[model samples]
Structures are given as structure tokens and as C-alpha cells.
Target chain A: MKIALPIKFVIICSFLFLIHQIVQAQDNEEKIKMPESNNVCLNCHGHKYFSFYNENTEINERKLMNPYFVIDSISYLQGAHQGHSCIDCHSEDYGVYPHIAELKIEPKLTCVDCHDFEAIATEVKKSVHMEAFGEFFQCELCHDPHSNKLVKSDMAELVRYNNNRCLNCHNDVDKYQVFTSHENPQLLVTHDWLPNQALHFAHVRCIECHTAVTDTADAVHHIVPKEQAVKNCNECHSENSLLRDKLYKHQLKEDRSEFNFYKSFIINDAYIIGANKNYYVNLISLLIFGLTFFGILTHTIFRIIKRK
Target chain B: MSNTKLYLYPVWLRIWHAINALCIILLGITGISMQYTNIESPLINFNSAVSIHNLVGVIIIASYLFFFIAGIISGNVKHYRLLFKGLLNRLFKQGEYYLFGYLKGEPKPFHITKEEKFNPLQKVSYVAAMYVLVPAVIITGVALLFPEMIIEKFYTMSGIRLTTFFHSLAGFFILIFLIIHLYVITIGKHPLKNFKSIVNGYHES
Candidate 1:
């Protein structure tokens, strides 16, 4: 009887140990499970004012003031990347709490991963923004992946946004003076000749005048320095002006089968004086007319002398 | 002076000539002003020059159509008919008369008639200018008017550039023709005789 009780006791103990092991295994599985959605991350990041403290400081600053911080989900939902998921950009073990130290590396995400980096880089490398900022000239500096409404935005609004970005630094008189003094203060003085100088400053984007004339506006990002800027007034003011192709649409005839020479006879809704003017044609006509007038005068003089 | 008055130009023809001449002259002035606008004190301001040029261009086109229609209907096109059978020989004779004979005070080789209003040289030059040059200028000018309507490229050059080139070239020829026409008209019995004929529909035969 004593031997049977000991064996039963051993069986009950083992059964209890097996049940405990199974429960422990289930708890570990639950602990390591991945987050269902980005909400886990956004829970802490979505707050506009949320920020973590620097290693040196214990106080939390506004996210905008913190250079290293997460984007607010509220603003991100309204951004150009609204359709994209956080994992698309994060693309790492950010699914886990306390992401690995590598996530803090410079250029944690590269634009060239999804874009034509070579073409964009070729243009941007020449830009003053790239030259002045050096290592800080990143896509995110000008274009926030969150809240970026670039492609579908109105042209005027886009211009305003781009120019305002420039004004962020330029409007600071002391900083502007420091920047300009090192470059050329004469360029700013040269703009004084323009009619309504203040209006131009207020309305026109700096790149419009500072950049080289290109076939497409997108290529205007290939900016040149002050020395290479277009100085000729006739480039924009004369007939056959460059602005004709740049600012306006050059619509070809709908019928492409046969060439019709008279296709350009329709009146434009708006006219730029020198852009559409056929000055070469007019000049040749005038020259011929002048030659005839003078020729007649000379001929008459010769005939009068012969008569005499 | 011969007192024999020939009714060469009709009233409609006279009116067309006057209007066409005015439009051409105005277009020339405005065109020059616009082209050389950088020169101080232009004949007209830049904006005014463009406005006048466009306005006169339309008027010229209208007058040209009227001239074409009226001449066809009235059988006045016969005056411009080129007799190609002996055209080269006649042209030579007319050329000799102008270059040498007229300077020596010799009489013109060919006389004006209602049916054969233009001389041999006049027939060739006027026919080429009116039928070829005038049409070319008008077509190119109209093409330039609606830049958005045409193909962007013509062969190697832009449509605008090509049209401008042809329009200018044709205008140059017309200007030369006008000068020569004025000079040739003065070669009649009196200096102002041809001018008077266009105004009054009478020419001394």
C-alpha cells in the first residue's frame, strides 16, 4: 500500500509540472507576438507635442524642435504618402519596442530606393541648396514625405510653398546679410532696376531668375550659381522669348497625318507681346520697304540730272 | 502731252488699290517700329506698334481677298495674263528699254492696253509677286497668328522660326517690287501720270 501511494504521488507531481510548462510556453508566445497595426507605434508618436529627451537632458521638447523624432500620424495621414504603410518606409524591426540602434543611423531610409536617384541627384547636386547645406541637403529637408502635396498642387501654390521654404532662411535679415556678403551683394542691387522691385520680390520665386532656362520646369532644379544666372533682358522680353516654352503650353495640332502650315492661326487667350511677335519677318519687310524708298529717291535724282 | 484718255482702272479697282496701299504702308511702319523697339524714340510705342500691326494685317488679308474675287468676276485678271509663247523675247526687249533705251530717252517697246495692261517685264514680276510671294507671306503671317495651332517643328526648324523666315523673305521681295513699281510708273509720259491714272481711272495713251 505504501509503495502504491508513492507511485501515485510521483504521477500527480509530473502532471502538475507538465501543465505549468505548457502555460509558460503560451505566455512566452503571447509576449513576442508582432503588433497588429502601426497603432502601436503611432500610439506614442501621434501626439503633436510628443518627444523623447536627449541623453543629456531629462525634459521632453516639442517634436518639431527635436531633430531626431517620429512623424505625427495625424499629419502623416494627410501627406503624399497617405496610401503607403509605415512598414513601407520603416522596413526594419521597428515592429518591436526599442528599435535597434541602427535605426538611428544617418539616412536610415534612402529616396533612391523608390525614385530615379541618379537623375534627381544630377540636378540637385548643382543647386545652391545642395552646395550651401552639404551633408544636410536631404530630400526630407525640403519635402516632407508626410504632408507633401507637390504633384497635384496648384502651380501658384507650389511656387508659394517653394519660395516660402527659401524665405525661411532669406527673410532673416542678419542671416541673409551674412550669406550675401560672402557671395555677391551686387546681385541684390542689380534687381533694383526691375519695375516694381518689391512686387517681384514678393511674387516671383528666386529660382525662376536664378536658374538656367530649361526645356521643362522640372529641370529648373538644375540651378546655377550667381555667375551663371541669365542677365540678358532680351531672353524674356524679345520676340521668340524663352518664357514661351517654359511658362506656357506648346500645343501641337491634333491632326498629325499631314502637315498644315496654317495651323498656328488661332488667337491665344492671353498674349505676351514679344513672345509671339514675328520681329524677324517684320524687320525684313521693313528693310525691303526702306531699300525701295531710297532706291526711288536715287533713281529720281539720276533722271533729273540726265534731264538737266 | 497726249490728250487721249484711256479708262484703265475702274472705280472698284481704284478703291482696292488705295486701301491696299494704305494698309501695306501702315503695316510696314508698325512692323519696323516693333522690330527695332530698342532704338530710342521709335515711330510708335511697342504696344501701339503691335496693335497697329495686327490690325493692318487683318485689313490687308480682307483687301487681298476682295481684290482676288473682284478681279476674277470682272475679268480684270486678263490684265495679269502672261503670254509665255514669246515671253522671254518680250521680257528681253522690255529689260533693254528700261536699262538702256529709257535712259537714252527712247520710247517704251510695249504700250499699255485694257486687256494687256502690264508690259512683258511687268507681267512676269507682277504674276510672280501676286500669285507666289503674296500668298506665301499671307499664309506664313496667318500661321504665326495662331502659334498653338501649328506643329511645333517643320523639318529641322521650329514652325515659328520657319514661318518668320519665309514671311520676312516674301515681305522683302514685295518691298523691292513696290520701289521698282513706283519708279517704273514715273517712266510714263509724265512723272505723276500713273499715279493720276489710278486716282481718276484715266491714263494718257
Candidate 2:
């Protein structure tokens, strides 16, 4: 028993000693390299000795100032156009840090890059503001470059300008009054003279009385030719509501030949009439339909059992 | 005929019974949670609860088809036939007893046998729920899911508003019935008797 205990002790000791040697050898080996920096700034900032350095030259150059491209450089770097460098916009004489002294070109808005003034001018000429209403003396008279106050697209700037200009020409009694006697009445003071004559002074105009614009898009409307002017008039006057409804009924007519293809919105009576009265009857029909289904089921089951 | 061990249910019936039971429990929990979102669900995520309810609905339908086919093939249509016969009297009496007599410690009006496990009242209610309510709920749920399809066809053929109203009303009724049915299940001989029968496909004598 003594011999067996000593042998067991020797075996356990040898196993533990082997584990200790392995652990000691592992501890003597090289330690693992830690990350030099934590954030994205460190990705391009590490040196050969594993110290932090601002090694990306492009990033360093961006921090420096360039004179020739001063405005372009700041705006380009600060805004979404930052990905591009100074040479992209300020082409020649870009290498020198102080940059070559340059003449100031006219500052342009971002919108001018996509727009051609000549094309827009043609459309503006045919607009209501230019024709019957000389509200805008010219298109540029109302529109400004940077602030863009009156140039909000498709708004009723024409009506506002027209009312102001009309009052300027009509505020005097000489132009409108015919009989100036005390007993006699002026035509403008007559109760049945007009509906919106006072409203005109309150900044309402001809378009408010004669033309009904749908949205902002229709505020700046184009004048159709005399023959085609009848089409715009048809909106207020319909032939028959039922006749319009029957045109785009998708049931019997398998083909959509008569359907308005522009927005694919079925321009039916619902869109025009703006109210639906059939909902109540439809709900009653559905309840009746559900009841009828249960009735049929119970009847069939009873009939089969009776025959059996 | 003389054998004491009556093998009344088959493996398919057992499976259908278990799945149907699970669907009922799932629907009861999820449907209640859906009605009262302020209440904390035993399950996490209300959307997950809804998903479980839909999945359980599909499982119940599959199990129902299986049970229906088995009922036809096994000549168990007689069992359902008795449901229609004297249904009103049975339903009224059972309803009355539950309302009044059961409170006085009176015995149940009907007994369950292997052949006629569901009494007249039970069969009628089960058949109504299975054939009528289940189909109505399924149809309405399907219509709700594909509203645009129904609107496209029914707008000119019918009214979309009416279809939507019916679908919503049926859903409301089904949800109400689901709550009442769960409460009624608790009123069995013992509170756990119905639960045990559903789980193990057997009821105590």
C-alpha cells in the first residue's frame, strides 16, 4: 500500500510539472499587438513603429487654406460637394498654396446649372401675368436671385401684383365717375354694379372671378388657342353626370380605351360628384347576402336529412 | 360489440383534436390580447401574437378539413344529424339550465356517449361554429387582406365601403364569440374536464 501511494504521487506530480512548463513557455512568447487607435481617424494615421501619425496627405491639405479658390473651397468642402478637391472646380493655377490672384466672376445659384433661362422665358411670356394682367412688368421684375420671395413657383403672384397695380390706376374718382352731381349716383356705388369690385381693393383680381385654378400648378396657366379654349370651359359645364360615369365603367368594357391614361385615375362621377350615397344600401345587401348563405346551408342540411 | 375497450377515436382524429385544441387556446389568448392591447400578453410582441393567431387559424382549417372528411367517410353524419333534430329545445333547455338550474347543484340535462359525445345543443353550436362562423371569419379575413382586389372589382360592380363594413362587423362578432366560447369551456363538469378531453382526446366517465 505504501509503494502504491508513492507511485500515484509521482504520476500526479509529473502531470502537474508538465502543465507548468507549458504555461511558462507560453508566457515567455511575444505579447499580442493592441490597436493603435480606436476611431476612423486612426485608419490612415498609423506609423511603421505603430505610433499614431496624421499620414493621409489629402486630409492635411484640406486643413490648409487656398486663396484663389477661397469661396469654392469652403462651400465645396462644407456642403455635399466635399468629395471633390480644389482642382475640380478651380481648374488652372491650382498647385500653389496661396493661389494666383483672380478676378471675381458672377456668383451663380445651384438652380441655374439645370435651368436654361431662354426656355423658361418663352413659357412666361404666354402666362396670364404677361397678357391681360401686366402685374409682373417683366418676369425678372418679380423674381429675384438669392431671396426668391415672390418667385415661389405656381403661386398667385400674378393676382397680387394685378390688384396692387389696378388700385394704383383706379384709386382716383376721375377715371371711374361719369356724373359728379350730388343727387345723381356713381355707377361704382350701385348695389348691383359687380360682385368683387371691393374685393379687388382687398387684393382679389380678374382670375379669382373668371378663372378657377385647381392647385399651385394652375396659378401660372398657359393660354390655349381660341379653338382649344372651349376645353378648359368644359370643367364647370358637364353634358350629363351619368354620361361621364358610363364612359369609364370598367365592367362590361374589357378594354380601357376610354379610361383617362394620364394618372390612371378613373375620372368617374365619384371624383366629380364628390359624395357617395350607395354605401348604406351596399351594407344592407352584404348582411342579406350573409344571411342568405346561412339560410341555404341550413336548408340543404335539413333537406338531406328529411330525405334520409 | 361485446368488447369493453371501445376504440372510438383513430390516430387522425386524435391529431385533429389536439391541433384544434391548440388553435382554440392560441386564438383565445391572442384574440383577447388584440382586443385589449393595454393588457400585457403572456407572449411577447403583439405582432408576434397576431402572427401566431393567423398560423393557428391556418392549422385549424387544415385540421377541420381532415375531421370533416373523416366524419363523412366513417358514416358519422348521423351524429351531426341529431344536432339539427330538436336543436331549439335542446339549446334552450341547456341554456336555461346553465343560467338557472346549474346554480342549484342540479345534474346536467344531457350525457355524452362515444356515439353521441356532443349533445344536441353542443352539436348545433359546434356545427354552427365550424361551418358558419369559421368560413365567415376566413372569407372576411381574406377580403380584408386583399382589399384592393375587392375594391377594383366591386367599386363599379358594388361598393367598397359596404364590403369593408361587413368584413369589420363579422370580425367583431367572431371576436365576441371567441371570448364567450372560452368562458363556456370553463363551465364543464370540472373546470379542467374540457381542457383534459381536448388535450388527451378522452373524457372521464
Candidate 3:
């Protein structure tokens, strides 16, 4: 009975410790500010060319030398989860020096695991990626874990940030091929019909044209098919530019208006040919044109009468 | 000798004028088309208009350079010289003739001369149009074409937007000038006489 009591007590203590560890793991989520990742696992995993020895085959294999296994410490330290310990998300089995082979297939953490992306998921349901890629279309494909940052510093930064994400997959034929089975898909050739493609790409985000128009900026997740994309120039060029809704939608919360009457182009810094029409300027210009035309018409009548 | 005509429009000047006129017309059409790109009822396809506008802009730069160099070399630039003394008085007289005196068949307030090709009003108008507005558009156009060279910001506003505003405004003024020019050409001896003078390089003095 004495042996049984000690054993039972030990088992109870272990169960409590397991629960405490699980609770600590969850608490670590909030504890991370700018994760430095002081985790001991980084000693090997953070190496430029990390590899492991296969004991079963008695072969010195570099299986972990694949780019996926080696995390670039510089970028990892700069990333959102920079403060995170590897085990915070990864399986505890990873603590083993020569990790068990099955640990590789353990359900890995995804962006959605931490982020409340229910709104985005709803939008993504309508995306071509959802239909074509299904679950294979992950956030990491567009947003590389290492370099990811929600760029909101300025308009220029936002444009560059947004464009870089799209080009990562779209511009690289090798990477692009992985997504689409279409033979020989070239970004330039595909966009040949678009005038000044370079200029458009540099200034605007790909999602401006590719995504479905919605009130929320998260509508970016709803990337429509190419055919459904905005091809009409007037759609963005008109006074009621769709860009005001899509690309610059982030700046909507702030008062973009300048000088009460002066808005649109001056504040946004976009002088879109047809989109940034000034009401007062247009009215005055047209009035002058009308007066000049009328004056010419009346003068012509007088000249005709004098000659006759 | 009194009946002898002045060879006002030289070969180079004629060629420059023809090209400039054609470019202005094309640019005006394309500019308006680009500004009001109605997909449903477009005057010109947006891409086509942009291509045409950009191409003409380049040509205008070359054409203007030719005019600038040629005018200085040819001494034809002397005609643009203005005397500010009694300039407003002369301008008012010229304006009165066009508005009322022309209907009454009164003599012209200022006649075209070899030394003074343009009247007081014409001199000022030509100087403002050629020296002021045209160069304004050209500068702004070049800045817009190569935006990297422009100032990043003008006050709180973007330099690009301000440049576009200036370019568009200059183009608008040019459009108004073009209409007035076309109409004024009909004011000479015969409706088509001024037009023929430009082509044939002769003007009755």
C-alpha cells in the first residue's frame, strides 16, 4: 500500500507538470515582443548548411541541408516571431539531436494557427487559388516567413512590399511553374497587352488589378482569375478610381483631404490622367472655353453681316 | 515695289510651323482622350492615345529644339522683339479693330512688316505662347516622362502631381491658342489668304 501511494502521487505530479508546460507554451505566445529566438535548437537549425547523419543506412547524408531546414538567422531575428523558441510551435521531438524521421510530417504551425484570419479565409474561399490550389495555397507561398512585415511606412514602401510578394511567385518562372501547369507562362508575355507594364508594376500593387473589389482591404486575399481582373483603363483612370478603394484603402482611416477643397491627387500624390479631375479647375477651364467659343461664333456672325 | 510681297515664311519656318501645328492638333486630341477615357464611348482607345501622346511629346521636343536653334541662326527671331512703350495702348487699338473696326471695314491698327512681323498684341501673345506656355509644357512633360529627376515633394503635395497639373494647364492654354489662331487666320484679305501665305511663303505687305 505504501509503494502504491508513492507511485500514484508521482503520476499525479507528472500530470500536473504536463498541464503546466502546455499552459506555459500558450502563455509564451503573448510573452514574445520581438522574438530573439534564443532557443538551443537554433544551434544546428540556424546553420547555413545544416545536415544530419543517417544512422540506419550508415550513410553521412545532408538531408537537412535543404534550404527549408536552415533558417537565415539575420532574417529570422528580424521576422515577426523573432522572439519565439523553436519548440513554441514545433513538436517537442525536435529536441532530439538526430530527430526521429517521422517528426518531419508532424502537423506544422501555419499563419492561421496564430492569426484570426476568419475574414480573410472567407474572402480566400472565392479566390482562384482556393479553387486551383485548395489547401496547398498557403500564406507562406506569397509571404516568405523570414522577410514578412506588414509594410505601412509610406505609400512607396507599401507598393514595393505588395509588389515584391506577388513577383516572388509570378516573376520567377520556376516558382510560378510550381503553381500553374500552363506551359511556358511568362509574366511579360502574359502582360504584353498591358501598356507600360513596368510602370504599372512599380507604382501599383498586383492585387489592385487581380483581387476582387470589396470594402475591406482583406479583399486582397480574394485574387480573382486573370479574365476577371481589371483590364479596363477607365476603371482606374476615371474620377472615381478603384485604386482609392483598393491600393490606398489602408490610408482611408486618416483624413486624406487637404485644404478642404483640394483632395484626391495632391494628398495621395497620384496624378492619374482621368482619375484626379479637379472640379473647380475643370469648371473654370470649361467656362473659359465656352466663352471663347461663343465670342468666336458672335464675331463670325458680325463678319458675315458686314461682308454681305 | 509697293506691290512686292514679303517672303515672311521661309522654308525652315514653314516646315517648323507645319510640324508644330500637326503636333499640337494630335496632342490636343490625345490629351483630351486620355483625360476623359470613357470605356463605353472612348474617342480613342486609352493605350493608343497614351502611345500617340508620348510619341508626339518626344517629337515636339525635337521639333522645338530645331525651332530654337534655327530661329536664333536665321535672324527670324527679330520679329518677336517687342517695344513695351505704348504696348497696352497699341494692344487695345488692335483689340478694338478685331472686335468692332473689322466689321466696319476700318484699316488695320498695325500692319505686318519685315522688321516687325507681329503687332504689339501679336508680339506679346506669341512671346507668351511660344516662350512661356510651350516651354512650360515641354519642361513638365520631360519631368513627367522621367520622374526620377523631379523634386520628391512640393510643399505637402507631390511634385509629380504638381508637374502634371502644370503640364495639363499649359496644354489647355495651348488648345485655346490653337482655336484662336485658326479663327484669326480667317480674318485676313480673303478667308484662305493667310493659310496660303503660310504654305507658299508669301504675305502681301
Candidate 4:
């Protein structure tokens, strides 16, 4: 009986150990890399060359029916959805694709479905994008969910990135017409009064001038109309250059060094007239002025002393 | 001392001179401070300086227009004319008087007459200062005010930089001329004679 009881006790302990391991294994499964869970769906959707206008345009005049599904795996993995699984917002039925056509009718998910972005929505309501485009304006219009990073780019990259976002719609006629029937305005022709328009475009973001100056966190989205945009030279070409407050606002701490090619004002490589101040140049001018004044003084003293 | 009064200065001339002097002095003060601004110790705040500079710029342009139109209409510009024949010889003689003879109580180099308002050296310097430097500063100042008119690039430097350099250089030369102009007023007979004439429209000779 003692041997049998000991054997039963050993069996019970072993069973409990097995149960503990099963629970731990289940916990570990949930903790696996979220990207791996998305990999199953990516195998079918992930393609870099898969574009909206593909070779089969002649076959179907209608827009591609499955345009949304073609997510480039490289970009998807790099998106801000590091914590999101495919089923986080999408229906779990999507994970098991090629099975049911009924699954295709599943309602599309929005940013607010998973994220607590009520603040962003509130900001958009007050934005010019919403005011001009009406209720059709959404976050994904400007920010692509497939590949958006947090604010991490440096000043130069940020300029290019922000300007590109503006030009994507502004510089494209078809894209601009998608929102309104108005004829697209030519950028160069309209801005003929602005000097070095091309160079200005490369270094400065459009939002710097187009947007109203707001202390709000979403100041960028609050664009002003054409008449209201900053046109005054003093705004940028002064001692207190608004460039620091606008485009370079991100790098003020790191970029407060002495001016070089970009010195005196607006940019690092360009010399704006009002904002230029070189120590050596000023010193030489002052020395010449002082000597002139001294020589004048000496000449006057001579004329006075010689009047005998 | 010669005690004959001459109507060398007129009312229009006096008014123009007053306004021009005030505007130029203000422009010099504001312009120099702006060019050599020290963030820690600025003579004028940047915004205020630019605003003042612009306002003064407009006033100066108006004064210059008045001077130009009145000088032509009243035949005052004729005084600036110089005879190119023997001009160098006359200039040298006048230069010699100012340099050595004036202090020794020598006779005046060029007598003041209705037709001869300025001496040989005075004609040359006044013409250069009024014609070359004045117009140069005005054109460049307007260009700076409306920077859109300036070309994007010059030969090697930015058009704005070149414009700024020329503007400052011209302004500096004007400032120097002002000092010399004031000093030479003390040259003939009585030092305060010219100052009184500019203010009261009569030069005692």
C-alpha cells in the first residue's frame, strides 16, 4: 500500500508539472513576434513590384479589385504597427484566406478602431485639408499606414519629406482633381515673385509659409489660404529668423552654431541680406570708419592750429 | 571781412537740405546698427530697425525727387557744371589753396559770383557725390526693398549679396563725404558763415 501511495503521489506531481508547462507554453505563444503572425497573410500580399497600374490594364478597364491587399512586406514590417497582429483590427477570417468569398464583405477598419486617436480626428476637423476637401478627408490621405515612421528624420530629411507630401497632391493634376474639379494651378507661374523658387523649394517646406503660425502641436495641418501665407521678407530674413521657429524648430538645440554658408539667416548655405553679420567683415568696416574719423579729426586740428 | 550779402541759398534749397540731412543721418544710424548687429547688445531691435529703415527709405526717395525736380526747374543744377578744358589745372589750383594757402590768409582761390556758385574742386566732388553715389544708393536701396526685382545670381556671388555690398559701400562713401562737407564749410573766411547761409538763405561775402 505504501509503495502504491508513493507511486500515485509521483504521478500526481508529474501531471501538475505537465499542466504548468502547458500554461507557460500558451503564454509564450501570445508573446511571439507580432510580425510572424502577419507573415501568413504577407506571403500572398507582399510584393514590391505589385503596383496599381499593372500589365493587365488592357484586360480590365475597371480599377484593380484587390488593390488594398498588395502590401509590400518590406514596408509593412517597417510600419508603426510593431505591436499589431493581422487580426488586431482585421477580421480573424482574413488570417485564413482563399477560403470564403463571404469574408471579403467584412467591413473595413479605420485608424480609430485600434488606436485611441480622437485627438487627431479633432485636429483634422479644424484643418484646411478637411475644410477644403469636406468629410472625405481622412488620416490615410496624407499618412500612408503601410509605411509611416514617428518624427525621427533630421532637419534636411524633414524638409524633403514634408515638401514631398505637399507636392504629391499640389504638383499632380489628376490627384488634385480627385478632391475638387478646379483646374490645378501652376506652381512656378503663380510664385514668380519669389526669388530662387527652386532652391527655396528644396530647402524650405511649403507648410512653413502656407500654414498659420500656431503654437498647437498640430500646427502643420492647420494650413492657411493663399492670401494668408507669409509673404513678408522680415519673417525669415531678420535677426530672429522664423526658419528656426518653423522648419529648423526641430533642430534648434543641435544647430545653434555660428553661421557658415547657411549663415546669417534662412539657410546654412545661402546668404540672406538683412540677416548677414560676419565678425571679421564688421571689424574691418569699423576699423576703416574709425581711421577715417581720426584722420578727419587730425586734419581739423591741423587747420585750427595753423590759423596763425 | 567782406560784408556784402548774397542770395546764394534759396528757400527750396534750404528745405531740401534740411530734410536730406535728417533722413541721411537717421539712415546712417539705423543702417550701421543693422549691418553690425550684436544680438547681446543691439543699437536697435531687428524688427524696429527694418521698419524704421523702410520708412526712412521712402522719405529719402521723396526728398531726392523734390531736389531733382526743383534743381532742374529753378536752374540750380547749372551750378554743378564744369568746363572740361583746363579742368585739371583749375582743380589743382583749388586743391593747392585748400591744402596750403587758405590757412596762410592768402586771397580766395575762386571768387563767389552769381554764375560761379562752386569752385573747380567743389564742382567735381559735388557732381560725383550727388550724381554717382546718390543715384547708386537709391537704386540699390529700392532693389533691396523689393528683392523680387533683383536677379537670382550675379557672376559668382548671389545678387542679393552683391547688391548689399554695393549699397553699404556707397553709404559708407556718403558718410565720409558728409564729414568732409561739414569740415569744408569751415574753410572760407568765417566758419559759421555757410551754416548761417544754409539756414537763412544769405551768404555774407
The number of the candidate with the highest TM-score is 3
- Model 3 residue A268 CA deviation (Å) reads 1.8
Q: Show model 4 residue runs off by greater than 4 Å.
A: A1-59, A64-269, A278-284
* DockQ score, prediction 4: 0.11
Grade the docking of candidate 4.
incorrect
- Residue ranges of candidate 1 with Cα displaced over 4 Å: A1-235, A239-298, B39-43
lDDT of 1 by residue, B1-205 (tens): 5667789889999999999888877876776556555423556766567668878888889989998999899998887787789889999999988766877798879987766788899889988877888888788878767655556556644555566667767776776777688779888667898889999998786
Of the two candidates 1 and 4, the one with more favorable DockQ, higher being better, is 4
Tens digits of per-residue lDDT, candidate 2, B12-57, equal: 7777766776776676566544433332223334455556767776
Q: What is the TM-score of chain A, computed separately for every candidate?
A: 0.52, 0.22, 0.71, 0.64
Off by over 4 Å in 2: A1-308, B1-11, B24-57, B82-85, B145-148, B151-168
Tens digits of per-residue lDDT, candidate 2, A9-123, equal 9999999999999999999986433222212222222212222324564333223222221242232233333343333333435343233456235332333354555554555
* lDDT string, candidate 1, A7-114, tens digits: 999999999999999999987773322234766566555554445655567666545423225566655665567667667777557765446777767355756678
Instruction: Tell me, per candidate, how large a share of the native contacts it keeps.
Output: 0.13, 0.00, 0.57, 0.19
**Which DockQ-derived CAPRI band holds candidate 3?**
acceptable
Ranked by DockQ, top first: 3, 4, 1, 2
The TM-score-based order of candidates, best leading, equals 3, 4, 1, 2
Error of 4 at A269 (Å): 6.5
Number of the top-ranking candidate, with DockQ as the measure = 3
Interface RMSD per candidate: 8.9, 18.9, 2.0, 4.7
**Candidate 1, position A297, lDDT:** 75
Candidate 3 residue runs with Cα over 4 Å from true position: A1-32, A35-88, A95-100, A114-116, A144-149, A171-193, A214-218, A252-262, A297-308, B1-6, B100-105, B146-159, B188-192
Q: Which 10 consecutive residues of model 4 chain B have the lowest summed lDDT?
A: B33-42
